[model samples]
Target: MLCIYNLQLTQTHHFFHSKKGVPFADYQGICNWLTRLVQIENGKQLTCNRNFIAPLCELCCASSLQIGSLMHAFDSVKSALRVLEESVALNCEEETTKSCIQYLEAVPWDDSEEEEIVKVASRLGPIAMPIVARISPVDLTATRNVFLSALRFATSSPGGEGSGLPFGDELRTSAQEQIEYMLGEDEETPLVTADDEVRSVARAGLAQIFSSFQTIISCSLSETTETEALHIVSDLVWMCNVLPKMDMMKDFVVRWTEASIVEIIEDNRFESIVWGLKVKVIEVTVKVLEAVGYGTVILQPTLRVQLLRTWLPYIRKLKPILDAKAEQDPSFGHRMDEDLCQNIEGAIVSLILALPSNDQGEILAGWMSGEQVKFPDLSEAFEVWCYRTKSAKRRLVEGGLDRVGNGNGRIETTEMRDMTMIPSAMVLIADTDRKESLAVKGSRK
Candidate 1:
């Protein structure tokens, strides 16, 4: 009995001190060491080699099933976050900073573990949101970004888990507010300085957030939300303005323009701000025109029609506004000082010209005759018919007046000709009238 008890004691001692003398370890053994490390009295004493931890994480994330076995991974990560938080709080020594980084390194780049980190960080987002929020280092932008990226990845992946156990719908709106907080409020001004994969991933996450704003703008019921929706639209436009411009991304611009036209302007709610709103429309119109002229193809024909269709009615309305206002001011409404008129005219002309040339005259003619066609304002239509008549006359003069010729090649030779010369006939009639008047005056004399 004494011999058996002594053997058991020796075995237990050997098991507890197994890692004391080992210089390096196999991957599986490192996890067991990590599991045991958490239980140690002085957990910080065991030096964590990032080299071993990182590789082990890579191997674990590569297997989907291993995630279930590593559920307690968050404990170590939470401890690391605590160290990081405290360091930031104390603004401690450089050595403490080094130790904080070491702790982070040991947390592993595994997707599952990274996801767990995100779960903890999400609570910080809305909780940290304060009244009259301001962007600053204290906002913890980097950590927020890291958490967001991980959260998005895990949620979107085919079989990854995240903060909201089975699934989360609020992720979109929540993520949107968090990012918009950083972007709009200027918290830490997250710079783009990473490789393509990282940068693309980040941009995609941001786009998703903005997409939520698009939804709100679409579904908003109240005037206040509608106005707020416009502000959000402005934020999105600002984002597009600041980012690297791409041809493919013009759809968002189109959507934004559509929303502006339908939601804000069409209802005519803000009548006082019509001019400002019109100016915005004009700017977007110019962009669309340039895109069309340059042969940038946006797939939505309805969007093209929606934007183009607004032009004529808007222009005609502007004519009345200019005329009414001009009646009030002599200098300000000087006929030649028609900047708005010119812009509207130029936009219509460019848009028409951009369409096939044949379409221009036809649509213009319809517009002139009040045919209610898909294009051309009444002014444009009248211009078209007048130009067509003058063009025909010019052709008749250039090619003998006996007949008019067209691209069809030949005019009929048998066409009727005028018996009297127009100029000669007019002169003869005038002379006869003068002679008769002279005869009558002589008789009176």
Candidate 2:
């Protein structure tokens, strides 16, 4: 009774006209009073006026109503939480959301209180998603089952409205959101906490996705039926979107050509589905190359050479064809994504840069060789390689990478010729036979 009478003394509602908004100084007082209302030991809290929610929300945007201060009592916590949720920004710019997450993370559940929260969650929607997302883990089989369902919808062949059937864009939107959240690329924290665990979960999901790929390839081999060939290509590409971000998948990309269907890549004369699948292949190749190429996963010079050699010709040939098709018909689904092309160029440039100057020249000689297909425009890689070769020894001496510190307290200079991890952005002149190759590399175009 004393708490109710005291809170009523404060003119909490009149201070905000809904036009000028609540005065900033009044924020602390309102929060304090609300806490008192919830904290009252007498059951008067059950009957407190619920009318002030709107003006209260206005102040909540900048309120000092801490999450910890309310958790002691369910009535108090729920009352404060209702106001806090009204205030929390989706971008997490508000202090209330942060404190709430930390409190929920640290404290054990008030199951009865959370039942009310879960009810609030059902009505308020994704704004309440963070609590459910963070609180607990679902069954592994349940997780994999939903993933597989999304995988199926995603992998189904591109066709009419009837083909997509019950859930079209909504399923895709959910899958993409789920993927981003699982990968920790979402605005909220990753559903999985540890990086290793995230990767392990990701790899398990990738394996399930890729296992379907193996099935598709094996079944598609002899006849190349539409059902076999095209049905799962989208699934492969869908999973490819995940590949570049995984550090362990470098070997998968390096050894890719063995499992790859050469006919689809080699023969561009195929029908639209096959052509689309071809573009899908290039997309996957570009992603994996990025995984290994951009210093994400290190490879020996020989592996780097192999990676470039395997995919170079296919990309060189496919590049112009994709552009010409898109130019010829704007509606073509197999058209080149400008971003994918940019990644291809960038990934190739990094791989080329990692090699010896002579290998770079030889590899680049293959580029722009055919006048008809000068699509990738390797001039960036060529120019950077040339500049680095000329400045090799000087930059090596300057950066002190020319010699290595050994356990025996010795500095090694001559063995530095094999150093592959050159800092090309600043002073990346790999001493790996750069001196010997320059004369030979210089003589060529």
Candidate 3:
């Protein structure tokens, strides 16, 4: 019995001595050691001991670390989160996961370190979010709070000065790349399992981030100067372009349209903003409409009419600028013109097609008469409308329908020809008007 006791004592001493010899006193050493702990096959068993727990808690409490060290520390924290998630998934170790969460929650975040905080969040969010999403009932509130705090730091104007320039483009690019990697593209398989719980939690987290983003933009628009507002709007547009591409974020389209499009249109100050800012706003607006137009959600009739009223004037105002730029640099400017025109026309046509046939006819008639509405070029819009109508008719015919349209039976070939001829005539009229206007301007010049 004495010999057995001695052996046990020696083994315990050797184990602790080895662990104590590790330089957890230094941040880099702590990170390295924690990374190693994360890689261990039995991660839960390793993390349960005070040797690992105490040092992590100590590191979290440290307030004197520089920004560079904080970033490295966050990397280690991310690794630790991965380990905790894997351990819980493999062994249902709720206690270990809880302890890890508490340590992570203790980490102090300083608002003064905005850029560094953003860097850490952008890197850590992608990794930790997936794990938090997948793990079962592990109380990730503390972890999620950390992520939200980081995002708020990232999106807000630096130092509460309201400069509207959140950070450099590189940080935005890095955050976007990380989010893309986490969410994956529409065609690609998701990085996590398709479990309903996982998707639910992930969506909830994203919704929080988006809500925070909306709040930031609202505050910026109301409180900031024109230059600052431009900064905010530019960054918001970049985010809108990125977030809508995630396959799981279908609702982002509606939320973005409601927040940005509706708000911008209603803002009385919109017309007074700089012309360059107006163009950026229009670009983002068309992008939202195009993305959501492809989806099943139909815009309300009132909103559709409002959008037409708002965009038609903007398009007319933009035509001269586009024309001059295209004349100066045909390649780049024409490409921009074509892309913007296609997006706007496609979106408007989609909205028109969603309306009942009677409403569609009314809208078309209004455009043709230039009575209630006047657009820069109705030709492209009419072309898209004709093509969509033809496709619908073809599908009906292929399905063996003898007639199309509500209450009008047996549509004849002559009616189809008339449908095509009317738009062609309108196109000719529009072309004539445009040529005459250009000639008048040229003579004056």
lDDT of 3 by residue, 284-364 (tens): 667666653444334455554555554555565555655666577656322235677677776766555444344566677
The residue pairs found clashing in candidate 2 are none
- What lDDT would each prediction earn against the true structure? 0.43, 0.57, 0.48
Candidate 1, 1-445: lDDT as tens digits: 3343235434433443453333334446745555444333333444445554443332222221222332333346555454334434435344443443454454454666566445534543442233113222344556555645743552242222343654442453355345444444243444322234435654664466456554553452365655544444444444443332322345444554455444435454444333433444444445454443233433233444455555555544444554566588655422323454455455455444333224445646545665343222335433433443445455556767635543445332233112111223323333453455556557879
Clashes of each: 1, 0, 0
Q: Worst ten-residue run, lDDT, model 1? A: 415-424
Pick by TM-score: which candidate is best?
A: 2
lDDT ranking from best candidate downward: 2, 3, 1
Better of 2 and 3 by lDDT: 2
Report the backbone clash tally of model 1: 1
- The lDDT leader among the candidates is 2
Give TM per candidate: 0.32, 0.52, 0.41
- The residue ranges of model 3 lying beyond 4 angstroms of the native Cα positions read 1-173, 185-224, 248-250, 259-272, 296-313, 317-338, 371-445
RMSD of each: 22.4, 13.7, 15.8
**Which portions of model 1 show Cα errors greater than 4 Å?**
1-230, 236-244, 253-260, 268-282, 294-306, 322-347, 366-445
Supply the TM-score for candidate 2.
0.52
